[model samples]
Target: MGSNAPLNVSAMVVNSLESSGIDHVFLVPGKLIYPLLDAIDNSPLIRGIVGAHETGSAFMADGYARASRKFGVCAGISGPGTMNFVPGMAAAHADRIPMLYIAGGISSHAEGKGAFQDATPGGIFESGVVRSLVTDIVELKNKENTQAEMRRAIEGLNWMRRAQSFISIPVDVQKQDVLPGQEVARQPYAHGEFNACEVPANRAALDALCDQYLFQSKRVAFLVGSRGNDAETAKLLLEVAEGFHIPVATTLSGKGAFPEQHALALGVYGFSSHSRAARVINSDELDVLVVFGSDLNQRDSMNWSRRLTGGKELFIFDDSFDSPAMGHISRQGIFSGISASFRLLAQKAADNPPGLPQALQRRKGWIAEINETPLYDHRFEQLGDRVSSGDEALYPGDVVKHLCRILPKDSNVVVDSGAHRIFMAHYWLSSGKGNYFSSSSLAPMGWAIAAGIGVKLAAPERPCVVVTGDGCMMMHGMEIQTAARYRVKVIYVVLNNAAHGAIHIDAIRSGSISEQFTKLPCHSWSAFASSIGVAARVVERIDELDGVLSEACQYDGPFLIEVITGVFPAPNRYYAEAEACP
Candidate 1:
């Protein structure tokens, strides 16, 4: 009965993941995915991370990918369990984080017969749940071609980390043994989704960029994005900027893409950006703007304001510009393979050094003004003494400022959505470590609570911290228990405002009738976190906050620090500019 039958569809799928450098698979156990889950549990090379919920698992996979620069993998059963992955999938899609999603599906025999949890094309809801959100979907109905289907799906993800790839295998097909002579996908190969095919720069776009913009433009600036945040690109980018004397600015999603302290840096140009950065990007006098890896969506582009792209020569470079949302934006959309283009430019910088652009030199006074401006000049640190009715509550901005000052310069910080994200992105001075990450496009509520666990798992040597809010903790906060289960050393600092900080502040300021719904229940997060076996502390004073954070950084296990923050004095005006897009 066991004659030459060592591998089945499930085994092959698990092997493919291992060969592709996916050492962990985050998932929630369910009926249909039992075969795959069983294989994952048995695999010696891959660890299965069972989580509290499917979406939390998906977010963990996303964080792992962001931290490791490898493909993230997660799974769920069909229908309900699979549907829970929507928000996380959409977040990964918008941020262009590459991931492989494997989920169970309808049995091959009962696919169109309305089988329970059927995910067939004719089943209930059809594929409407994730049909549009993911990059591509692979449905394996025939066991004979399972490997081929997986290969096709992975190749699509390889093109660019643009979206999550889905693979759904019918329960019947998942249990079937591999056919003869067909590779069972057990044989190891090079990494699958990272196979970088050289996408040569669009010759026409490159010519225009060189001739009209770089050589002849009056003023040029480099606006880098998340895609250009890697190590090699940073150095190459610096080479080109130093060679051509182009001022560099980054989108909010692209923070830490360039050294903020560099003389040529204009800080961030999108949400919570410096005034000089906005002026430099939108100025009519600036001749050309070179954008690498940003989609310039509503948030980054000021809701498609004419001033951003209308008056400047915009050269947009990336792996591809296929987003339909970008259709209205006028510019030369170049498929330049960002790293390749940067390498070429860096080489040119060494061979032929063009003198500094005279136009850039003419703007020296303006550049000097922004450079002279201190990044941490906001005066909110003294607010606790003056405000808060003597409750010993701290401002969220001060919390972020103190964390940035004391947290190890080498640590990786994950910013979750809420008032905390605004303060961190706007006030945290990046030393160009390229370790700061935020899911800006989607901005899901409790992402970092789960994602930071995955981040810790991915980079065990690096100290990881999650900056989140009480409102976010109310959402997927139990994910901290998942961190505790694994003993992931992520220090979660929750700003306990007893309300949705941003909305509450807005209600109080706007005098709006919606204030009734803005307040949240006051609860001791440290107590709850401790009950779940996580080391917990409630910071009651500013003087003690630094010591708490420092201790947590040195701790060997998961920790949570709840800082009771007063929502008032609200991060000053400059750091709240991101609300414009919201």
Candidate 2:
């Protein structure tokens, strides 16, 4: 038996998070989790952000993690509230973003009973349906070992695995007092305390893999992902790229991993890829393809295009590389940081410096020339006249162009999943100083709306922008109010093409499907933002974009720029791939 001094498990959990350096916790207030919420309220080191919906809350956590480079935290109750975390958590899992979802389950003794929201073995609602989506699920039924279990779970958030973690605490145990308050206040979790994490490959194997696949290759290319964004890793990556005379390209989620303006830079490859990047990666001269911190599962992988990896020797550095069929030099992920330890070993002899391939030189010049003007896809021949006229009355590119042109030097842009994201991804040029993040695979709509709030809260110094579309706004547009309530400064540029942009475009272009289901009422997002206390302006033309964005950039509080544009598809090859799927 333990000391019966007053110590609440909920209170200890909040303290543990604070000690772990988690400053914020997003949640939708629920009865079962009230104790934990109250604990957060009393804590001086942590804050509780009440969200409009659990899904939005989860996404805010995802955004927070991406912005701060720290694991995100969210809370919910079992059953319905827990259910809302699926799409958001799945998105994080797909993007390999680190996050933790804490849910309050029914009483420990209430197992198979008719407890309202029990998720236990024989409960009415078994939340384990999301087991595969999350990295780990822990149900805390034993009250005594709560602190130890909490530490283990928090430490589990290391370099790899996939998605967010689910921690279910029983209601009875949450309120129970089993130890002294002083003992409970102990720091159970710390940001870097658990540094001894498992590396994907042993040092010897990694070196050998690099020797045969990297150093021996005549032409090598680097494809970095989200994990390649850290300062040390990015610096090391640039050094390695220069050291090896390699051209560096990034996955969709890795836009800012390397300075895009560099001579050796190849922009994003995959769905919203640059012709230059697709060409570089798919070239016959390429002998090696090295990927970092990404599974390359999203459009970032061009729907796992065989041509992308067909004849090349592929090397990857991500803790979450689970794709068995694509093949690799090492089945396990190689840490991007390992470049530090292996750089000298893989260095080309100084006397025999490799010259840039003649073909690559031309392709690089070609890409730079293409980027000199506004990126216009020749594939969309139907809209050639409107595209040439520079009328965005149906094009979101104008808005992205204007925003990219005027955005502050240091800004954080969080893009939601939609046609608008494709525009932003395809056109936005990054300097490696600013931050860019998007949920790739399980791209739940409205993720950026809430995620923008989290980004603003996490990186308060930078100008935060959320680029979303009408379909996403309809999903969780009200989350802007959450930003407004906290006085969190963020710019939301909602591209209202009046429909689910991509679906509508694909359906209309395919001619095999009904476009009626893809169309939306084209609701006025500006009016909605004003109704909810977020200042907003509607942009219906290209001329109105520059100044509207300039003023929004200077605005201190949350602002929305609703650009009424068209669903002009990005020059993406996805439509063809999707058509071929059947």
Candidate 3:
């Protein structure tokens, strides 16, 4: 819209970002981004700040994007900067969050010419990031041409609901001319048709199938996924379970989709999930597992070949139609997301099916049985309840659990990876699917704290919680400052076990039990968060968790709760090996 002298590619880049509505750039500055730094200093459009690390920078951007549902930008120097951002990029991709990555280059002209610190940015991030590009700032015709290139990059980013990277304005490019450019489309954001699986034309046919196998099955159950976490869908899922007289189980990601406190709601399924949920999956009582968008991976699947053998256990229905049903690939058609399918089920079952009362009763009975299971106890297992009061006490799980219990019940949640993951997955609990997310597959530390920032950004009205562990906090803990700087009130829960809990268990199991090596002394993380302009507290005892969490729920802005819990005992390899062997 406007023109500036000085004529540098960095100025053009910064101008384009500000014009396009990017507010802050999360970064760890390098010589390559000197122009951008200069541009940011000169212009009021974008705020450029340093992060503890590039991953943290990317995570901060991700957090901003998630909380705002707009684009978040992460910038750094080419090689190392790009490398550090890779893990966060992968997390964004896997979770389907949009992010814009800006990296400084040696000189587009010297990319492969061995010009000083030049490295092929594209190949450098091939495996981790979903998309990337490299360009020469100096080669551009002028400011106009530079703006056009920037627009194209933005367009490419919008095309994918994931991460995209652009290596811009090498040192040479920074010295290039700036020319005016044309505008890209000035249209409002569009919500395109969500990719979904198709349903059959004849409702009668689906109803017939349901009656033949589902209604007749003695031990039918439901496994709801994130796609069907809405109120209408939840009610429908509950009704269907009642109609068929089957109990309903969920994944950690699927939690809060089915009210865990309900009689029919069996807790999360997986190695780290509640024993009650695990028992249902492992038992012979489960003859027909009606799955809805629940991708039965390691976090929810325990182990692919073991636990709930899919052959007879699964009755899958999804929109993609790729046969997400365990051991039951469709002969024809794909599965859509659970929304459409759940609606159909609800419509068809308005009559409550044939034997609804008996099914509901049976589900209730099973729930009662589960409630009696002593093995599922987590009452004093975590630290929040034990460490309330004294201003510096919180267990990550306790904060998460309190948030789950007291926050707007319909809120969305995002978690990262850590020993805290197990506690959150197994104990914090949610009412349905899609309400909770974490690095279940990757289990990378530092993921949730940043992800929490993203979740709050993505769904601002809904209360968002990010569950992190001590190890995870260190990785992206610095971003809490970013959240504070941006005025994003994302609730953070850090499990402070004083060590890499999972690795500690793994090391010991491998016969290396050096406490000195595995156990790191506790650090004052809450004070650190406070230093960064956020209200943070630490919890040591189990009883203190809930009350402090209740108090934290009242405040707004970025908040941190550090809970102390021991590394949970590792699952015996006997089961993992059994599946691996045959």
lDDT of 3: 0.61
Which candidate wins on TM-score? 1
* Native-referenced Cα lDDT, model 2: 0.73
Model 2 ranges off by over 4 Å: 1-5, 108-113, 161-163, 181-217, 230-232, 321-394, 574-582
Error of 2 at 43 (Å): 0.6
> What tens-digit string does per-residue lDDT give for candidate 3 at 130-155?
35322112223244566566766665
Give the winner by lDDT: 1 or 3. Answer: 1
Model 1: weakest 10-residue lDDT segment is 380-389
Cα lDDT computed for each candidate against the true fold: 0.77, 0.73, 0.61
- Give per-residue CA lDDT, model 1, range 1-582, as digits (tens): 133665788988887787677888899988888899878977888989888898999999998988887788989887877788888898988788888888898777786676887767777563577887887888888887887888877754543545578888877788888854455344544886454454555556665565565654357788888878755667778877876667888877888777777888887766666656776777786778888988887666655656678677787898754653687686646778777787777665555535435534655655575566544344533354333344666767677779888987768788899878767876776766667878888889999889998888888888899999899999999999998888889999998888787777667767674867888888999999999989999897788898898889878899999998877644434334444533
Most lDDT-accurate candidate: 1
Clashes of 3: 60
What's the TM for model 3?
0.72
